[model samples]
Target: MAEIKKIGVFTSGGDAPGMNACIRAVVRTAIYMGKEVVGIQQGYQGMIDKKFVPMDARSVRNIIQMGGTVLKTARCMDFRTPEGRAFAYKNLKEEGIDALVPIGGDGTFTGAEFLSREFDIPVVCVPGTIDNDLYGSDYTLGYDTATNTVIDAIDKIRDTAASHDRLFFVEVMGRDSGCIALHAGIAGGAEAILLPEKETAIDELIEKLEQSAEKKTSSIVIIAEGDKNGGAYNVAKRVKEKFNFYDIKVTILGHLQRGGSPSSFDRVLGGRLGYAAVKSLLAGENRKMVGLRNNKVELTDLHEAIHNHTFKLEEDLLEMANILSI
Candidate 1:
């Protein structure tokens, strides 16, 4: 590959906390390496529409604490087509963007892989989704902040639930992954948790709630969005049938879990991954995802990061969560 003189950076897929921090790191790191950085306003869509901005150290000042991406993000369906990708490439070449750094989740990496292979553009990805579903990185950028946000909501809900002796079914975001739900459920002292990875029949959930109700316990059941037994509303209705306490309530955290000031862990992780991504791109690495494993920066093949998912929480942690909840 030709020498990487200028690097283009963008954030894609869902907006995540600590994204701005990552953007800042990418800009500063690239600038420090004497490479000019171009900020793509909205991922591949921005590339196609020519939404580009020159970034320097001053441009990213004081954005590390921000909740969402300063570069913004979006799902560009058009980027899936060859014509759209060719257009994006034309725009990139026109803008003098020689290498690329994209921060995002699985879909983001898949797009990166496609573009890199098609055009031979050097690309490095930083895992920046709240889902934490990607295989290579143990922790994505926003997982900590989102987990903290859910626990904060759960703690507040606990106070009201205890007062009213209410059974609260709190739904958190984790489509196709239970990382958030499992972490928050264990931390928030939830009585039961429904995860997408584990299939729990409604009857079995009712049996657990029944046991709680018999003890006059004010319970909180954490439900992941992709739970096998539908969502929080459905789980609440089914549990209300047989396990009636003083009251029953369902609270869907929804997107609330996605927006918040980036936690210290997220900010640091974002900076690390972003810095490593630029370094990787400069090292002539292409179609690679930058991640932190065992507290050190590691690079994984973008194709494997997108296609091979072995993300699993400790089974013993789930077991201990159930035991401790009781």
Candidate 2:
């Protein structure tokens, strides 16, 4: 293992709620270990473009509770190519960054792995996405905050829904993974949750809404954007054909779920993951993801973490979402 001198860290892809906390932890933890830290802005693209910022203990102060990433984040397709990656590697070498901590979703990890293997740079990925779709980690960095944001919106929607006898189709973000939708749906007490992981027939959904409508004055159906049936607007349109709602409303929620002050759970989880990532790098661990499982930090091989990973919503929770809807 090369004597680690300085580490480079960045948050890529979509910005998440607790990313600032993680960045704060990484900066402070690395500095405490007598290592220098460099913050890369806008992720891999920043590396390629040499957008590096020197960081210290004071740099991360008062940022643990902030929403979004102080480090900023951007999707970089250029980093996927050999020419672009070579440029990124050259930039890292010039900055004397021996190891790296790239925080974000699986796509972020994929880019991190490529850069590490191609240039022999040490890396540890931190799951910082709100989707909570990663395989090894029990929870991703911003999932808790995102779910809370959704539930809060739903609660507000519920007030109006109750007053007007509205049928609300609330859409939450979850591209290819319904983890956020599933959790928030259950927590928000939706009439039904349409997840990408399961097939929810329109007829079945209408039947459920009809039943709920008969008993309650209003109804809520949570839909994951990745749902096979389509998004909230389409689902609401189809449902209106069969079910007559007093007032049908659609709430996209949009990027609001991606922005918020980190919840206590997310803030703490980000700290743990960031601290573990830096510690892992110090232990000569490379090309792995630092995740909390069963409340402890564990490492998973980057290859396995990226490739052979399958995300399934908790079956019991799925069952309860229906059972409790009644």
Candidate 3:
């Protein structure tokens, strides 16, 4: 085990609400442990560009409550190439950083894995995506906040939906995963939810809406962006063609779900995951991810964390959503 004297931390992929909180945790934890911390700006691109900033407890002060990463984030096509990774590693060596704590989703972890294996660097990761689709962690950092944001929007939309007796198609994020759509749909009391995980036929959806129309003055159907019949716009178009009796409205939540003061749950979760990530690296752990599983912090092999696809939506929750809609 190499003695890790300095650690580098960065946030990548889509910016999540509690990422700043996680950044605060990483910086403070590393400082307290008598090690130096460097903030890598714009993620892997920062390494290739040599964008490094010295960080201390003061540098991360007053940022725990902030949304988005203070370190910033960007998608780096350059990081995917071997020559790009070599340049990144060279920059890391020049900066005296021997270990890393990266906070992001699978794409971020994949890059970290490549860099670590190629350069023999030590790494520990914190799951920090709003998608919450990562396998090892039960809940990713900003997922709670993102869902809360969706619910809040749903509540407001319901008001207008009821006022005009309209059928609304509200679309939320989740291209490959439906975690946000499933969770927020249930909490917001939508009439039906279309998920990427489940192929919801248009006829079946209309059947439910017809059932809803008989008893309710207003209806809200939550749709994941990756739903098989296409996004909210196409689904609404098809539904409007046949079910034209009710006035319809389509709302794409877009990136709105990605920004917010993280919920209380997320703030604490970020802190815990960040603290755990640094501790794991200090304890000579390498190429592992720190995650919260079943309310306990646990470590999973980074390869498993990146490649495994076992995360599933709760069956009971799915049933409950269906039953409660009526």
Candidate 4:
């Protein structure tokens, strides 16, 4: 490996809060280390298209508090092909981007792993997804903010539900993971939470709602989008078939969970991971990811981070959520 002179940073896959904060940290950290920084707009697609922009401390100023990403992001099917990666490598060489910091989820790290191995480019990743499903990090970049957003929505929905004596099925984003649904459900005081990690039968859910109906005039059920019983609409439909007392309403948070200013926790985590990513690349580490584990910055193999998913919903929290909801 050669000394990393300039680093390129990009965000990919779905956008998340605190990405700008991560970008700021990457830019400032690299500059502080006497390495130039190039912001790759739109992620791998930008690498292929040569969408490179020079970045300095001034360029990242006033962006840490902003939500979403300043460098932009996109899903690039072209990047999945070898030819596309070759073109991206050529572009990186042309732009003198000797190392890379990619902030994104599993899909993002998978791409980085391929590019780094194929082209021998030094690359590090920062987890920047709202799902918080990644393996290494205790919390991904936007999980806190997204959960807070869901809690706010749940609070408002609870007010309405109480007034109308309604049964609200609030769906939150978490297609493959239940991190968002579990955290937000517990925080929002949902009567029942359906997660993708747990196979929740509609009949069982109805049974729980039935119990809640006996004790309360209004109820809230948090459903992850990837729940086996389907989304909030389907769950609400099935529940309405049997447990039809209060007027049932469904609210899919959708991308609402992905936007808004990041909370202090997310901002700090983003900054830490980004700073560590630059430091790792400079330290000659490649195909790695910077993550916050047990409140400390740690490094994990990118392949392990992408392939071996160690993220698990805490059983104690699940048990508590069940007990408290009752």
Candidate 5:
């Protein structure tokens, strides 16, 4: 077993709900295990620049309900460069960092993997993306809270749509994957869902809306931000022009989905995953991510997990959305 003395933690990529809870868990749990915790600010950039603060139990005090990470986060454009990663390695060595815990999506994990390999430091990733697209885990830490947020927005939009017999085009964030859009669309009973993996035909969506209009039913379309054919704005305009559904409106959920108190599920999962991540480091695990699989927390090699694409909507849910809307 490796001698786990000082462990470093950072939140990377986009900020998501429940990031604070995860950071709190890691700091508190690592402190409980008699290890000094270091909080790296602004993700990988902090590590490259050697910017970090000592994290204690008091540092994470009363932050479990917070929306964003107290340590903050950022996108490190230099992480891919040899100079940047080497600088990070030099800093970690100088700081005597024994292990690393990164809370982030795929891009963040990729950076962690590089650092782990370059510096011979063990990294245990805690998946913390709203996209819920990380492989080997059924759910990411911030996904449930984000989904609930999106669903809440959709519910409100539906109320206005129903009252005025209007058609609403709601946009949610999901750049490389459509998990958020797919899950929220099914849960919110959206009339249509546009994902990035598949092409959305504007004509087909408009036709469906036209049919619904004939039947005196208002429609709500959910579009992932990464939709191939522009976004909700373009789709809504086309529908209005062709079918004259002048009551169309557009609501971009934007960062709203990324902020709020994490739901109970997220809090519990974050704690469990955070604790397991520390345990992995103590157990001499390196360059791996701790994930929940088949109702058990397990570890997977970060390299394989990053390269493997694993997010997709269930066919049953898609079919149900089609049936319910039709």
Candidate 6:
């Protein structure tokens, strides 16, 4: 194994809760190993453009409970290009960086894998997206926190819905996958959940609402943002037309789910994943991602994780939703 000296860490893709905790853990762990840590700003772009800052224990202090990333994050479209990758290599060589630890989603890991192969430097990926769509991992770092946030919002919205006897269409964030929507919908006690994994027919949803209206005064339908059939607003319009229900409201939980104090689950998960990432680097494992499987932290090849498709909503839960709502 190469003598551990200075290591670089960066957060990429969308910022989420527990990111600061991950950054803190990596910096503290590396320092305890008698190594200096470099904070790369704006993810891969920072490396390619030579933007970096030194990190210390004090830099991460008081940030453990904070949401969002202290190191900041960005998406660099150019990093996939040969010239950009070459620039990253040259910059790493100039800075004498021994290894890199990237905390992000699949796209970020893909870039990390490319940089590792091109530069011959070890890169460790820590799954840190709220999406929970990364392969080989039961849960991503920020997923629990995001789920709790969505549940909280739903709870508050439920109170208003009941008071006004209104039907609310709550939209949660989840682009290509429905992990967040499914988990949050179940946990939040939503009446109906529309996920990307299944096609939600507007006619069926309206029929359910019309039937439920006879027994229940209010309703809440959680819809994923990536719902191809329609969004909450469009669904609300169709529901009003089909059922003549004019009290429908749409609330898009946009970035609110991404911001909040890191829950205990997320803080602990982030700490463990961060430590595992450093351990992987120390163990001479390169271009791999740290994930939890069988209740234990494990490593997987980043390339496989990036190329594999491992996302699907639980069928039993979907069936249960259909049974209870209809």
List the candidates ranked by lDDT, beginning with the highest.
3, 4, 1, 2, 6, 5
Best by lDDT: 3
The segments of candidate 1 whose C-alpha lies over 4 angstroms from its true place after superposition are none
Q: What are the per-model C-alpha RMSD values against the true structure?
A: 0.9, 0.9, 0.7, 0.8, 1.5, 1.4
lDDT of 4 by residue, 166-283 (tens): 9999999999999889988998999999999899888888888888888999999999999999798888888887877889999988998899999999999989999999998888
* TM-score, every prediction: 0.98, 0.98, 0.99, 0.99, 0.95, 0.96
What is the C-alpha RMSD, rounded to one decimal, of candidate 6? 1.4
Candidates' C-alpha lDDT:
0.91, 0.91, 0.94, 0.92, 0.87, 0.87
Q: Candidate 5 deviates by what RMSD?
A: 1.5
Evaluated at residue 135, the lDDT of candidate 4 is: 88
lDDT of 1 by residue, 156-221 (tens): 999999998888999999989999999999999998999999899988888777777777658999
Local accuracy of candidate 5 as per-residue lDDT tens digits, 126-242: 999898888889888889999999999999998888999888999999887888998899899888899898787888887777777787657789999999978889877877778
Model 2, global lDDT? 0.91
Q: What is candidate 3's lDDT per residue for 145-211, written digit by digit as tens?
A: 9999999999999999999999999999999899999999999999999999989999999999999
Residue 97 lDDT (model 3): 94
For model 5, state the Cα shift of residue 214 in Å.
Answer: 2.9
Candidate 3 vs 4: which has more lDDT: 3
Candidate 6 lDDT, 128-182, residue by residue in tens: 8999888878889889999999999999999999999999999888888888888
Look at candidate 1 and tell me the lDDT of residue 174.
Answer: 92
